[model samples]
Target: MTDTTARTIPIEAFGPGAQSVDVPVLDSHLHHVEAGEGDPIVFLHGSPTSSYLYRHLFGLLAGRGRLIAPDLIGFGDSGRPEIAYDLADHERYLDAWFEALDLRDVTLVLQDYGAAFGVSWASRHADRVKAVLLAEPVIRDIESSALPEAFVGAQRVIRTPGDGEKFVVEDNLFLTAVLPGAFLTPLAEADLAVYQAPFPTPESRTHLIRFPRNLPIDGDPASSVEYLARNEAWLASSTDVPKTLLTYEPGFLVTPTIVEWIRENVANLEVHAGGAGVHFVQEEQPQGIADAVVALLARAEAR
Candidate 1:
């Protein structure tokens, strides 16, 4: 059901020591890129991108620990099933990925939609998680009033019935616009193409389209709301597990209002300014992100 042949993404796209491992997850195979070895540092990328997103950090942190980055089901080169690409759908396959790889004592690096699934897993399996590194993460349901006007307008267009599909699928806004626009420094055509490669066809962009649509707007997508509530409880309760929140300027999900909210709500959370980026902190501040993870790993070991 899976290929162990390990297709290699060009180092040109991701940097040196990049290779793919196809593992049987759930009903199909999942493609993940990995490098180095030690305590596993699993990088979970958010919407509209794949394992390739962490190409820079994978080698940078090789001296510290194993770096494993997976393309969520229906994203990147991972298996694409004809299921509704909702939060539950992503989490179900991701749980299988964890089991398949037998990952434990995980240092989860989360961003964007990846936060939704990764945080939910870490909260439930707090015993398995060693630490968490978050950047521009979507930790809870969106508070529209706290959001930037531009972002709100964009969301409105994307969530609109006919417009959503045209923009996300047909026009391929996620890769064409959203991904490119997130970075503080613009991505080169070659580097940007790597992220764009996965969803070349509109039909292949099922997850990209659904990710925004499934966001917990006005308490809609009842399941995601319930999931975030549980995640919030776990975040507040799990003080034993270390949590690092890396912040950046002009961030979308981790905005100023959300930062204040996180301070009051999440327990045992240490927030550090990660320079500047809009949403894709990994794209803009890989070094800062890597340093934070290294520090968290050191702290975890010391404790």
Candidate 2:
């Protein structure tokens, strides 16, 4: 029987005092911040952002469970090896990180490329995943016509040989332009500085440059497209998994059409209106996200 007497955990302030612990994974180390104890609730950030993206969530999800957020390899404080920052490389490092931590029965909170990684891992290791919350995830193949003309043009420039390096590396386009534009509220100078700290040198921006180019769009990037298809299939069949999808107004990836498709395809799914935002819903609706996550946890535990 389910524990009906379980009490709700109160949220608190996760202020500037929060610190990250580095764990060695593979040849490098991954920096992560964790709070509370018991079952693990892991948060994964995407391109141009680090675990710092979920700083607000740690406070909101306090005492509910063990909350952990890790910076992906080549981003934030994680070690940047000389290998190409491709999807497979990131996946390999993340797999090692999870093994090193010996994490089990995890609840994943994912965004952007993080969603892709998390969902892929969950599909492969279904027993380890307890629940999943996705916001602005890269879960489907994208059509070129579906994107804004200007955004498509920019992607083309970013995918080109010499121009891609200039646009992403030299100009720091993802950090300078894309990240700021995705947020509804203007990010303060200090907050922007945190996002910029990892990519000080042009060469350090390799992962950022690779992200947009690797987007699974229009049947290209066959590898990502294949994995997304597998994840979609898993989502359809995994009716026992409690999944919550937070959708925002004028969202970049998970548009209304995509949301409707998710409604039809994904099983045991709950959709929550995440209020106004562009791509970065966490910045705009942290409370809403927390509420959804808590509700999903309850549902998962009820089973």
- Scanning candidate 2 in windows of ten residues, the lowest lDDT window is 1-10
In model 1, where is the ten-residue run with the lowest total lDDT? 1-10
Q: Can you tell me which runs of candidate 2 are displaced by over 4 Å? A: 1-13
C-alpha lDDT values of all predictions: 0.80, 0.82
What's the true lDDT of residue 145 in model 1? 76
lDDT at position 84, candidate 2: 80
Model 2: per-residue Cα lDDT at residue 37: 84
lDDT accuracy of residue 167 in candidate 2: 91
lDDT of 1 at 156: 90
